[model samples]
Target: MDRTPANDTWFQGKAARSIHEDQLKKVELFNGRAAMIGFVIGVITEGLTGQGILHQIGLGPLVDGYATCSVQMLPFCF
Candidate 1:
């Protein structure tokens, strides 16, 4: 069997499509990971700085109380 220009063109098209699909998958994975990392960092930064949603919604005091209680309870359990 002899390879012709038409066959070569078709093969090239398929290869291009496969390459495009692989690249798209990589981009999607990268975007998802980046978004997750950004969200985690934002939450941590907000929690540490004490200016995030928790503080804005008045949950900060409740959380602080819970933390304090936990610390107080540790000595009794031992």
Candidate 2:
């Protein structure tokens, strides 16, 4: 532990670490807000179109086919 300026700069105090942690917190908050907004938009679109999220994304047939095969006990659905 020579306590040189370079070593001091590399080892930050609690305040400096807190600043970086605050930035990460803000980023996580914004990401969570965006996810909530997207989910609400998806629900509204589904309500207006009378279609599920999967159907709106054009995966309804693929999902339905898989369900049918699974129910019929098909050997290889993949």
Which candidate gets the maximum lDDT versus the true structure?
A: 2
- The models' CA-based lDDT, in order, is 0.81, 0.86
lDDT of 1 by residue, 4-78 (tens): 999999999999999999999999999999999987887887878867756655788866666666565865542
Q: What is the lDDT of residue 68 in candidate 2?
A: 76
Model 2 steric clash total:
0
TM-score of each: 0.61, 0.68
Superposed on all Cα atoms, the candidates' RMSDs to the truth, in angstroms, are: 7.3, 3.6
Q: How far in Å is the alpha carbon of 22 misplaced in model 1?
A: 0.5
Please, what's the RMSD in Å of model 1?
A: 7.3
Candidate 2 residue-wise lDDT, 4-77, digit = tens: 98778767776699899999999999999999998898899999998888988899998788877864567688
The weakest ten consecutive residues by lDDT in model 2 span: 69-78
Model 2, residue 57: C-alpha shift (Å):
2.7
Model 1 bad stretches (over 4 Å): 53-78
Question: Which residue pairs collide in model 2, if any?
Answer: none
